[model samples]
Target: MQSIVLLLWLALCAEQDVRERQIANTLTLGVGLCALIFLFVTGHTWIGSDAEEAGWALAFVILLTIPGYMLGQFGAGDVKLLAALALATDRQYLLGTIIGSGVALVLWLLSRRWLWSLLSQKVKNRLKAWGDESSKKQPFAPFLLAGFLLASVWIH
Candidate 1:
């Protein structure tokens, strides 16, 4: 189950990185639906046996991410993906995922800024001119994926 989720997450990250910064509804919603079905059939989520924990996770993620979504700080796909992951993850591990994602995002932003500062003014101008609009917005899926992996390892 973990392996399958990891593969799907990797695909999502790849799609977000290589294509436009949009996540497919098929992947996000499909995983969510599958997690729901798995919970019904097995009385367990991907990471735990407690259905209530999954429910809480789902609710928590929705509530937490909705404001960001509303403010346009997060894309709809990013919120959906996080909500789906919350459903599949144990509540305890969800904290790790959230924290890890925040840390990763901060580090990525800082590193990118640092790297940009290192480039010559002419190079920066040329690169900025060549860069597409999509490059300006960092994709969240990869950071989320990294967080998920970190949580998985930390918990196990």
Candidate 2:
């Protein structure tokens, strides 16, 4: 199950990185629906056996992220992705995932300057076309993937 989630995250990261930073609804919603079905069929979730925990996790993620969504700080796809992940993760580990994402973002921000200098001219030009240095926006799925991996390791 964890491997499947990792593969899904990898797909999302690839899409966000290579494409226009848009996440497909089919992927996000399909993952969420599958998670719900898994919980129903197995009486288990990443958090526990309770289906209510999954519901609360979904609600918590929505409540937590909706403000950012409304403020345009986050795209709809990012919020949906978080919500789907919430349904699949334990509440305790979910907090760790969120914190890990922040840590990953900070690390990337600090390292990107040095890393940028090492990139080939063509790659640099392409990255520049993706976004300017001043913009805070960048593909976030990678950070999410890092966080998910970190939380998985830390908790288990």
Candidate 1: residue pairs that collide: none
| TM-scores for the candidates | 0.79, 0.81
lDDT to native, each model: 0.74, 0.72
Write the residue-wise lDDT of candidate 2 on 1-156 in tens digits: 774664466466545653567678776787777777788888777446367777777787888789988988877877877777777765765677678888998997888888778899888766663446666667777677787778878877
**Lowest summed lDDT window (length 10), candidate 1:** 126-135
Q: Show model 2 residue runs off by greater than 4 Å.
A: 1-4, 46-49, 120-131
**Prediction RMSDs, each to the true structure:** 4.8, 2.7
For residue 17, model 1's alpha carbon misses the true position, in angstroms, by 5.1
lDDT for 1 (candidate 2) = 72
CA displacement after TM-score superposition, residue 143 of candidate 1 (Å) = 0.6
The whole-model C-alpha lDDT of candidate 1 against the native structure comes to 0.74
- Top candidate (TM-score): 2
